[model samples]
Target: MGDSASRSRVSYPVFQDVNHMVIFGFGFFLTFLKRYGFSSTGFNLLIIVLGVQCSVLIEDLLIFLLQREDENSLKRITNAVVSMTAVVISTGALLGKTNPVQLILMTVVEIIVFHMSRWINETFLQVPDNLSMTHVHLFGAYFGLAVSSRFSEPLPRSEKNASTPKSDLLSMLGTLFLWVFWPSFNSVLAVDKSKAIYNTYFALAVSAVTAFLLSVLTTKDGKFRMTHIQSAVLAGGVTVGYAGHGIKYPWIAMILGLLASVISILGSYCLQRCLNPALKIHDSSGVHFTFGLPGVLGALAQVVLTVINNWTNSARQGHLVTVHIGAFCLTVSVALITGFITGLILNLKLFKTIPVSKYFEDQLYWEFPHLAVGF
Candidate 1:
């Protein structure tokens, strides 16, 4: 028992860090609405708790049935919580628009699909580590977008969807938590923790600097937009998700960080406006810019590095390249399709969807003091 406890204690730091990211980090990250603060954090808490329970059961059951083996309880729980991170990302897209019931249903369904996709990627494609980026980040972002595309209600002229100074400040706290702990997130399943941490730390540092610079340049009055800082600043962390473990040089990580920040800032500031009309996706939290694109960039970086290594070593690892490409394509297709179908189910009249007038408001879900309500 003492030996078992000692082994468990060794993994505690990473588990604690990931737990913080999933709860406090993501919970506060969603609290950016002027009036929807209660729902944002409250519903997020709901989804996460349920995800932790449901994901573990699903993952364990799948492993038992398919592989006829059981995984360590701690490892399964940790991965389950990490899987919830993707569900939280998806929740970000449909934030103010979804009712609690819809959110709960989405959480349950997404977890099943998430694990299924993960199994396929790891087992069939033989791309185990890469699933962290493709299955979680890429899958989460596109899944949310697919669901968003299915529900096309326009924000009413009177809707209180814009963030206030206080709300944005709270949201920044979430961003800081994610930023400080993201190296742990990127390096959680890595073979070499030191290399992963080194690359991720540099990448995130440069990404933060680049986000600030781009935020200033993009805005007319040279002011940093809270939105960019909250979202784009984390792109570097996402950029190193898959490649961090393999990245040897700090410079390469820095360059990837620079590129990721540019793409995130541009996508958030420019492409985001075009999403509704062009793709019919109403991503409430810009997850595509922050998680989806940066994740793909990270996965591509891994592929490129693999090709270069093959060339230099005179080795033919075409199978590896095929795995990366196949994993990417398969992840996109599964996430979007499953998400769209889930949206369609949630939209059924039985679900009792939120009315348009109540969008982004806390009154529908939370109780406030009479004095606060009057104000």
Candidate 2:
């Protein structure tokens, strides 16, 4: 009994670490572009704080509305952080494209959508998942991407290509913060404490190694790019979370990491080459590669390979395989529809508008050192 209690004690530190990842990881990682430092940190701060607060309320109300007995303040806050991470992921898709108020509105809509989807999954579907890929990664990425596509047309690059030595270094700091704490982020939800934690760490190491090697392998000059380092290295966790848990052998996780890393690296490259020029789809942090593709594909791949009866035996699963598929489809549809509507609302004339020329520059949104309003 004491051992069980001790294992549960890990929750507090897990909360602290995930908080660091958000406060530091998400903010500074997006600071790679030299010009957008203020928007990256300042607006990110605004949007994420709003996400956390709204998550607190939505999650609490959800508990009461559903009449859950085991739910408590600590669990609600933990879930709020998890949901807030999803919000942060969505914001990555719209980074530098929209203003602060737009994001606040989007966050409110997203949290409500997220909880609704979650409630359906919990109440009707009850499928157990070992990773955040579904809850946090896939929904946020796709939701943000859908919203971004709506706001996008044939617009010239809303952002600039300004990466300095210092910006790169700071980006690495954010990467380091994310990489170190990700195990805790994933492990916080683990039911089998020891094995799940081991799987998380193993997957992180393999994915980092794979992402680094693949990143180097694909680059023309054999020089490491911060984009790959800052993002794809974390695919190890995503890959593991996707479906590698409880496999009879351990090396399979390494292979999954390798595949996920390769896809992530190429996905980023393709978005830069094909999407930006053709459609002005500017994913500021290339989150599609790190979070979107990996999460969706991982979930699909796991579903394909996993035995339905097997999953039924896992905790909380009470439905047929078709129900799980329906839940995924429902979540995706709701996210896209909500995101599109949110984009339309942002485009309405009620909000403060940012000039095209000053899209990525911090001066438009913030008062800082020698802030210059674009003519």
Residue 109, model 1: Cα distance from true site in angstroms? 0.4
| Cα-based lDDT at residue 64, candidate 2 | 84
lDDT (0 to 1) per candidate: 0.86, 0.71
lDDT of candidate 1 at residue 50, scale 0 to 100: 94
lDDT of 1 by residue, 1-375 (tens): 887678678888899999999899999998988998998888888899999999888866877787857766777788888899889999999989888989999999998898888788877887774354435888899899899887866564554878888999999999999999999988877888899999999999999999999899999999988898888889999988877888889999999999999999887756666765687677788898989989889879988988877875544568778888889889889999999999999999999878777777888878887748457
Q: How accurate is candidate 2 locally (lDDT)?
A: 0.71
- Per-prediction CA RMSD (Å): 1.9, 3.8
Judged by whole-model lDDT over C-alpha atoms, candidate 1 comes out at 0.86
Off by over 4 Å in 1: 129-134, 156-158, 313-315, 371-375
Worst 10 residues of 1 by lDDT: 126-135
TM-score of every candidate: 0.95, 0.87
